[model samples]
Target: MRVRIAVPATAANLGPGFDVLALALELQNEVEAERTGEAGISVDPGPGAPPELCDPARNLVVRAYTAACAELGAPADGVHIRCVNRIPFRRGLGSSAAAALGGTLVAAALNGAPWDEHSIIDFVSGLEGHPDNAAAALLGGLVVVTPGAPAVTMDVPEELCAVVFVPDLELETALARRVVAGAFTRADAVHNAARCALFIRAIATRDWPTLRWAMEDRWHQPPRSALYPAMPELIAGALEGGACGAALSGAGPAVIALVAGAPEAVQEGFMRAASRCDLRGRSFVSRVRNFGARVDLSA
Candidate 1:
């Protein structure tokens, strides 16, 4: 039997909603798995996959597949996996989320296990140490995830497009998170709460003016911004170039601008900002994907 899984890339935080909000992108990673007569696992890495990811024993997909099998009380079996990766790794694009989902789905399909969406989310969240990216990758659309609760998904406006700027410098999530303060004052907490509420409503109602205010964050972005000095300029340029709102894509380095109409100005804004900072990077124009992870099985 064979199974094919497709998972979308995700952008988490969305400014004020730090660690609680995420949106799935049209960019995807595809994985194909087949059961083998032998009793070992093999993985073929896709283009741009890091050298470390090529090892089956240490790979995230292999670990996830093993975990899923254990969860289902199924014996570990031989499997061959081929990954066709497009999402940039470690750029806060939920590449890990895609890897985990792909492996979990492959295991479930092979075992004929009854794994529901929530179950999958719970399992992946445990492995990922956070739910934002995993929830967005699994459920798609715009997702709000809180611990001890099921992820809530809402439809993003079809007109909205994401203009992403990926910088050459890679920022690890651990390093990005290390710079943040352990706590926040009540005033700052209240401020973020208000903005998160506004952000949700603005997206739901397509209120561009309100969205501009909603994306203003005082918590994570400010502290993390120190690591990416070029980010502030990029965001300012995006807004100046007609984006409804813009924010750090995940941790640092990458920035995403939400736009309603043409993304030409937004794309240019990213390039111009990079030039001003004397940094080199690439830009992507992507749409919001309403569907999340999906799998197909064949005999």
Candidate 2:
């Protein structure tokens, strides 16, 4: 038996909604898990798959697949997994969430367990140690997640595009979190609360201009800027080029800008910022994906 799962890329903590919000992008990573009815495990790593994911013990996909097998009473022997990676790893783009969720879904399909959205989200979120990315990767569109609760998702406008500039820098999420650990003030909290609300409302109402201010954040950005020092310039250039709003994509070395109009303007703005900051990066323009993970099954 073989199963295939495709999970979308996600940008979490969009601006002010730190750890609470995310949206799915069209980019994806595909995983195929097969039960070969043998006694050992094999891994086929596809193009651009990071070295860390090649190991069975350390691989999130393998680990999650095995975990699900144990939980759902499925046979784990003779399993073969192949990865088709596209989302950049450790770039604050939810690559790990996609892997975890992909593996679990593949395992469930092979096991003949019923598809359960909440269980899948919970399992992947446990592996992720956070909900925003997993929820977005699973549900698509824009997702708001509260700790210890189910995530709520909203549809994003089809016309809206996001231009993401991923720099040469790689900031590990743990290190980035450490940079801002326990660093929230009452004013900072209040500031983010208002901005987060505004950002969500603006997207829902199609208020393009309001996003310029609505996406601002005083909480994680200030401290994380020390890590991704090029962040401010990148965002500034994107806005100057024509983006309605811009911000750090997550605990990012990648910056995401919302563009309601000319993508060429936004791309040029991103290039100018990269040049000015002396930072090297590439930009990706993708529409928000309203649907999340997809699965295919075969004999």
Candidate 3:
């Protein structure tokens, strides 16, 4: 049996929500797995691909495959895996989550795909160390995750769209997290909670005006601004260009913009902001993908 699964890239910790809300984009990482004579993995090669990303042994796909194989306790054939990745690494996009979800889906499918959606979610969440990005990758669109013994996800509206300005250089998530302080004051916590609630409401209602005020976050962004000097400028530029709200997509470098009207125009505005900053990269004007990971057997 041949299993091909595609998982969308996700942007987690949108604005003030911290690890709560995540948006899954249309850009994807595709994986195809097939049974071979022995238990091993194969990955396609490329000129510009990082050596770390190319190694199947240490790759997320192989890790997920090994995990699923261990769970099943069944061994018969080797696994041949092919990965086609478009999303850049360490740029605040959920490339790791996509790779993990894609691998797990293929593993389960190889075993007759017995595990249901919830189990898959739990599995991927465990592997990724969080549910926000994994949940969105597994079940796309806007997802709110409360991580614990068992994770829960609520599907958000598909009509909503996002604009992200991805910078050229990579900003490590660990490095970004390290810059943040360990604790926040009571007042700061309250402010973040209130804004996060308002952001959720804005998404639920699609109220563009409310979102402008709601998406502001003082918890992460304030301290995190030191990491990316261009962030403040991007936020100001986005608002100036008519974006309803803008925030750090995940950690840094990529600015997530909430737009009310035309996506193309909004994207162009973000592009202008990038140009102003002397930043060189692409801007993705994307809608929330309602359909998460799916297997195309034809592949």
Give me the overall lDDT of model 3.
0.78
lDDT of 3 by residue, 185-224 (tens): 7898898889888888888787878877888887888777
Cα-based TM-score, every candidate:
0.97, 0.97, 0.91
Give residue 84's error in model 1 in angstroms. Answer: 0.7
Q: Lowest-scoring 10 consecutive residues by lDDT in candidate 3? A: 147-156
Candidate order, lDDT descending: 2, 1, 3
Model 2 CA RMSD to the hidden true structure, in angstroms: 1.2
Q: How many clashing residue pairs appear in each of the predictions shown?
A: 0, 0, 2
Model 1 is weakest, by summed lDDT over 10 consecutive residues, at 177-186
lDDT tens digits by residue: candidate 2, 231-276:
9999999999999999988788889999999888999999998999
- Runs off by more than 4 Å, candidate 1: 181-183
Error of 2 at 136 (Å): 0.2
lDDT of 1 by residue, 1-299 (tens): 99999999999998888889999999999999998888888889888888988898778888899899999998666888889999888887888888998888888989999878888899998888778898999899999998888899998988988999888888888888777666457887898899999999998898876777899888888888788888899999888888999999888678989999779998898888889999998989999999898889999
Regions more than 4 Å wrong, model 3: 45-48, 149-159, 181-183, 297-299
Segments in model 2 whose C-alpha atoms lie over 4 Å from true places? none
